[model samples]
Target: MINMKRRTFLKGSVAAGAVGAAVSAGLLTPRVVLAAWPSAAFEAKSVDSALDALMGSHAVESSDKISIRAPDIAENGAVVPVSVTAPMSNIDTISIIAEKNAAPLTAAFKLGKGAEGYVSTRIKMGKTSNVIAVVKAGGKMYSASKEVKVTIGGCGG
Candidate 1:
């Protein structure tokens, strides 16, 4: 049996508590705590509003450099696989928009400097809609869209 003395236990607990307090106070940090998780953007009813909430504006130009790899007809809307790739320069972020969903903004991926502009994930869709991929590069937004037809509806039919 490992016997932890009362004084030693109290000291250890106090040290641990102090460390936690320091982290919370920004004294020790890489800043892992996310108190600002963009809830308003995800809950937005329309695509424009979602984009505004997320990135301050929705105006974006079409770009041939961007490509979306998704099935022309998704057998199930519950987990339709989608991938966006942009073999371009200076990509800052990649955001996916489901144009007809209740909350159109489905996913947003922020990239570090020089990181590859590519993301893949499964997203839910309520009906047939154009899935738009918006990429931010050099402080400008470029986009591309692909119509995805769903067979079995996922977002509340």
Candidate 2:
């Protein structure tokens, strides 16, 4: 006779519950299970090229309505904090572009219904570059950018 222990199915359920909590708290964006991921857009080398691939023929205008809050100087090129906030109606997506990175597009957020038009995340900077925040709302694209100087030590004294 052999005795087998019961599987920890509750543990898996707990993890799923945690993900639900994160979605409710807006900490993480839930992705469509079978949605196709955009590889070419994120793999584009230049900012303009990436934008063209993502937004097609649409014009991107610089707007004061979009605010990009990033450190004027980032001590580390490996991790730079970036945040974007816009008080606009019908926001569809927000994308963060690290202008000088090998792959310029760093993060793209697809805002769901009732989700606040704000996104904050840490991105890698290959060197000193302008971080641009692009927002799509009401069939128009608005953008803002800030230059962040990367330091050597990666930790300010």
Candidate 3:
């Protein structure tokens, strides 16, 4: 009787270990995965082209709802502080792009419900360029821009 109980306990432990391993390997996580590959706006040559690719041929209007804050003159082009804020509700995402930089797209933020649509980060500017904030709201695109002067050359400008 003792030998039988030991065998049964060992079998149960092995089964539990296998189930735990599977669950840890994403077998139990509920994930809604996207099928398509993510698009890259950074490699695009022009702002319009990057916007077109990002917005998918949709018309984007300039709006005051989105505000882009950056220094008019950046003493150091290597790292320029930039911030974007959207006053509107239901903001899906916020993307920051530098027009004249070699890689246009600097950073992107995906906003959640009840979360403020604001992002601040340092971006490298090759030269004086327009820093654009593209906000996605109500399945539409809106943008605003501010020109930032990069006095000290960064990115070999």
List the candidates' TM-scores in order: 0.73, 0.74, 0.69
Best by TM-score: 2
Per model, state how many residue pairs clash: 0, 0, 0
Predicted candidate 2 versus true structure: per-residue lDDT over 60-119, tens digit per residue: 899988889999988888888999999998998899999877678898888889988999
Global Cα lDDT for candidate 2:
0.75
**Ten contiguous residues with the weakest lDDT in model 3:** 29-38
The best-first sequence of candidates by TM-score reads: 2, 1, 3
The runs of at least 3 residues in candidate 3 whose Cα sits more than 4 Å from the true structure, single-residue gaps closed, are 1-39, 153-157
**Candidate 1 ranges with C-alpha deviation above 4 Å:** 1-35, 153-157
lDDT of each: 0.77, 0.75, 0.71
Pick by lDDT: which candidate is best? 1
Instruction: Answer with 1 or 3, whichever has the higher lDDT.
Output: 1
Worst 10 residues of 1 by lDDT: 26-35
